[model samples]
Target: MPIEWIDCKPISLVWFSWREPLLYVLFTPWLLSLFAGLLITALTVVLSIRLSWLNRSLIVISAVLSVNIIYSPLATQWLSVWLSSQLPQTFERAEDAPRPVAVLLGRGAKIGRATSRKAAQLLNDHKVEAVYVSGDRLSTAQRVVKLGAPAERVAGDSCARTTWQNATRTNAWLQRNHPEAPVLLITDPWQLPRAAHAFAGQGLKVMPMAISPQLNSRTRNRLALRETAGTLLYRLQGRM
Candidate 1:
């Protein structure tokens, strides 16, 4: 069952542009750790001329371990599972239920296409009333349109640059037109948790729909690390 109520604490939107950059710098655990390890390794190499061999070895070992943990598949798998654990293990909506409005969270070309494809499928199946592409609006909307969705049936926001913006901006429109309609929040599986939480925070009834992309281990781990950081950041900001 979809979580119907979650109180998202109000946050100041002042200086909102800084949120995304700061999130990666301050809240991204693996990224910050990577930078720290690289810096330590560089400094150790430079100071090895003066430091004792034992101390130098210890620094190098610590740096390597810190960097290696993020690349480890087991570590990534654990984090991925824990992150998505909050999402429903199973979901079912009655066929007679009101049709949901599809909301595709903006992303890169590959994910945009995948998400758009899903939205088109829902539209084609008459499962959704309409499709709204948040964030990268033009690109995503174009993809959905190209996939055969009627131009009039699809709409979007080109201004949303972050997940928070995606929810708030989309809600700005939804609250007036589809206030009572259930939202089908669409995005990559790894990002669905945060995306769902963000949309729900806006007081929209959200049903998560994740589209899995074909990704290599390296790419998948990279995305997982980023999402783990993003989830932490949103929690800190009281957005999730």
Candidate 2:
């Protein structure tokens, strides 16, 4: 049920591997941008050969596109910082109050590891009472347990294949188990906003916790462009 092919036996296990989706999400935008630039440049060259005046117009368009592509890294960094700023870094923890639960959005091993570590630390610090992991639930739960989280305090749901599903399933679980509890949502920096919106839409009080620290310029741009495309696609599908 973890996004694997049902009939194919040989490569079905590949679904458990996290690299495929990560690579797709991280590089798809850059690949599309490169393809578009090449196509546009070829078109511009063909147009300029016949109409000299059109050359200026095409050049301007290309220039603008190039600038946007080049500026993606900074834009992504700014967006990440801005999104992170929207959530509180510190929350009041009182002895008599119910402890907040940490919700880890599953994507890959690295993200799961980071979230697990954070969850463990928060547990140690008495910041959260329990940890709920979404995506490939069995594996994620195992990883969190391996990272030192108590098995009894960790819960997981494998049915969530997307951010929306993650939110909805987790919301349902919370409603049944810990209604009105504050949730500390954890995910990649680029996905913070969409994930937060999805969780909030379910009437859950979500406090986003982005795991990644500062990314390099090039990586930031690439991630930013990819996130932008992803956001637009989700919007078109009415997912976000």
Candidate 3:
């Protein structure tokens, strides 16, 4: 029987969805840590006015611990993509990923976020003919990938409404460039189903390259709610 999926739906939708870094950049986990540090710094100032040196010393120690624990790891994660490669096996599809033209979809069209390292290895080995990043040509890196097409075929793109937008824009690009190429759409597991729907709807043959890590935290949880609401708002704005 198909599982009812009622309980799993919201959690899967939130935890697995790729949050494109478009709005409220501060709400990002790293920036929120900065906000936490500032909060503690303010607290330290308030306490220093009342406490003696010995007691104030305790405040300093506590402040550093709070910020380090709450924020340092996030900063490390936001910065060190290398460290992430050391963590336990997260997503498994890429382990034996087929050499379909990697329809690498994400907010960052890099060789890392969606396992560009692995993708690059595959491309170098003639596994994937090209690394097609689907999104607006937001940076020079994206454009550079395209200038060397066939050998690279970067194909930096844009005009996406959501994960769904990534599908539509990529299809148009594919039709213009490699229409016969099969797609190995890469995205967070949570988003793959939704994105797959849009791609299949567009009459494209696709295989999922689910490569995102599971996000578990209060902030990520809240972001899920925010995304759901934001999605509704976009629908209202006639943007979706």
Candidate 4:
């Protein structure tokens, strides 16, 4: 039987997908901030022509402050630290529950490879009974298999495109097959907070395991900011 999903719909339309250019930029951190700042500046500049000096001054100040806050390295750093703090140190095992299955949430080829490696390691160590790749499923699953995870022990679906979808889809699968199995929710450190919350919201037992790729400071800050924005958006949508 096919499971019904709540708070998510399977992708049947291409234009509205999150991967579309507009939505992608809107969700991405640095790009969104830069675009917003430019838009605000342009609008205020045009509006200033009709306004009094004081009003123009106010708009300029507001624009500057908003841009500074969003672009601030300190803000991104602080948000990254706070997000990392929300992750669980270890999985809470239950005597009667089946051994945890690693549910690797894919980001991209780089991070997905890193996460697949971690999942393969867990399977080899017997820390997890099986591995399931969500998000970018096929490529990640192939990587996991190549990493030495037995082909029979790895499974996944390509239906998930977002963290919310990853959780809900995997939860539906778990409910139908391994109802009591704990999930080792694997992803990058910055994304772990929102990803874990999303999985837990769908009533899965989630234990976050971060396997971040090697990124420079600039790239890391961008990802951290993106995750921060994602967390807030999810909260507003009540998905977490």
For residues 144-196, could you state the per-residue lDDT of candidate 1 as single tens digits?
77787777778876667678788897898677667767888888888889888
Candidates in order, TM-scores: namely 0.77, 0.69, 0.46, 0.77
Cα-based RMSD of candidate 4:
5.3
Question: How well does candidate 2 match the true structure in TM-score terms?
Answer: 0.69
How many residue pairs collide in each prediction? 0, 2, 7, 0
Which whole-number lDDT from 0 to 100 does residue 118 have in model 2? Answer: 84
lDDT of candidate 4 over 117-202, digit per residue (tens)? 88999898888888887767476787777877788778778777778878887887788767888898888999998988888887
Instruction: Quickly count the clashes in candidate 3.
Output: 7
lDDT of 3 at 41: 60
Candidate 1's clash total is: 0
Q: Is candidate 1 or candidate 2 better by TM-score?
A: 1
Q: Residue pairs in steric clash, candidate 1?
A: none
RMSD of each: 7.3, 6.6, 13.1, 5.3
Regions of model 2 farther than 4 Å from truth? 1-50, 53-72, 82-96, 213-222, 233-240
- Candidate 2 structure quality by residue, lDDT tens digits, 46-150: 776675756656675675476465456556667666555544333445568677889987666666677778887887677887788876546766666677667
Better of 3 and 4 by TM-score: 4
Q: What is the C-alpha lDDT of each candidate?
A: 0.76, 0.68, 0.52, 0.76
